[model samples]
Target: MNHIPSLNDIKEVHERIKPFIHHTPVLSSASINELAGCEIYFKCENFQKIGAFKARGGMNAVLSLSKEEQEKGITTHSSGNHAQAIALAAKTVGTKAYIVMPSNAPIIKKNGVKALNGEIIECEPTLEARESTVQQVIDRTGATFIHPFNNYDVIAGQATATLELIEEVPNLQVVMAPVGGGGLLSGTALATHYLLPEAEIISGEPEGAADAILSFKSGKIEKAPYIKTIADGLMTNLGDKTLEIIRMYVKDIILVSDEEIIAAMRLIWERLKIVIEPSCAVPFAALLKQKERFAGKKVGIILTGGNVDLGKLPF
Candidate 1:
């Protein structure tokens, strides 16, 4: 598959994932906008199937696989959302999924994976450990590996959400998403480039997991330190493919503190009356961090997920 997705490829991805994923709403709040001093449109992927946008890429990767490969099964590693994405996608495609999750991953996410019949392999909460465990599973089961955010097909699948957002609300000056692995942001950049070329693609990242910001500036891949943040889903570092795409397409990446993330998340829940995970609030935190830059601008924010364990509410 081409690393670069054409407009047609993005359209096809929408069609492919349409039956399996929800075209989540583009929401806005007068109160939140008044507070942030910007016209912010939220692409609520919190409402997506599996309660996250990863369902698009994960399902697309599964559907893009050959029948022979699908028969063998699908495998991936995720701290939370993508594990459930692959599991749900595999179930939809009539294939088995093997997920390597961090031993410390949220029990809600673990239960989500198991409920979809995905076989879970718990590994230490580190990219190195997850990669090693995934390799072991691949070797044992001869399964096709569907990387959560690195593969071309997966990125293409991720693009559809942005595509739908642009269609719903065109003339957006900037589109932003919480960047973890770059799959969703990369896809978003492509969609904005083709559908709304005037739009700028911005990425929001946790300061604790600011590898993407470092990599974008340094022109190389960088790993995040082992700092614990509420945004568990964004803890993993970026991949080579994702890094390259972000370097080319993304205009800027802003980092926010964990405290800001929690506050932004609380604001969203209170104002929007929706459940958004901490990872999802990073973009709004970015906007708040730099309110002058986005003042009076029509900004689109992708709420990345809603799968928070109620037992562990940060607020």
Candidate 2:
């Protein structure tokens, strides 16, 4: 039976990765609420290991493999976060990690992978280059490919973050996350389904890179040919598995312009006194832009990652 992940599946992931991951704290800013006219709770995955929530999915993907598969090691292509994730996951499991990164990937992220001892393979930034390069790595090493957002184990792992979020802050009326490849958002939809059944699952997508919103409207999965945004982490197109779950469970997808996203990022930095990447700010941008719609509601926003290059602050 092919379907969305069950509650128990996500629960198991939560328990399995408990020792390796953080039970990240939920923080809120009254200034944000005054500005948005809602009670907003931020599940700050910025504080998670590897500086992002990708750790949960990546760790789960690696650990879920049979001992035989684990011995073969793991490989993945990521611009940043997932690369470090798999590298760390492999390290924890005592296996090799072959990380494929784009030539133009941020220095901060590339250095993080190196610090974790993952072998780095640089390639052209195009999707084709990434896929082909990863395939070559897999063929040469026989390593299992852990897709950034498409694998079942990874999706279940991503769900554990939201499961923790809802459990910590019960009675959320709306839950939102930035939608890129849909791993986090899809997993988030599953969390809302089981934990906060009355909560509406929403997505925040960049206006310049709104593939998820387009797919939701067209009733099918679609690709974005020229996605350009400050939110680099949210630029990837949605995968089929993620799209299926998103279409079935997500209630709405909101589009926020680059200007709005940058503004929201600044607000969070100044108000919360925390560092978050531009991609992490997409959901808050959605909430800020649509203040009236979410007024008087309890909203949970997943700050997906905090892997930003300090040298390139958009403000």
List TM-score per model, in order.
0.95, 0.97
Q: Which stretches of candidate 1 lie over 4 Å from their true place?
A: 124-129
lDDT of each: 0.89, 0.91
Q: Report the C-alpha displacement of residue 225, candidate 1, in angstroms.
A: 5.5
- Tell how far residue 157 is off in model 1, in angstroms: 1.0
Q: What TM-score, to 2 decimals, does candidate 2 have?
A: 0.97
What residue pairs clash in candidate 1, if any at all? none
Scored by Cα lDDT, where does model 2 land? 0.91
Superposed Cα deviation of residue 197, candidate 2 (Å): 1.3
Candidate 2: where are CA atoms >4 Å away? 1-3
Count of clashes in candidate 2: 0
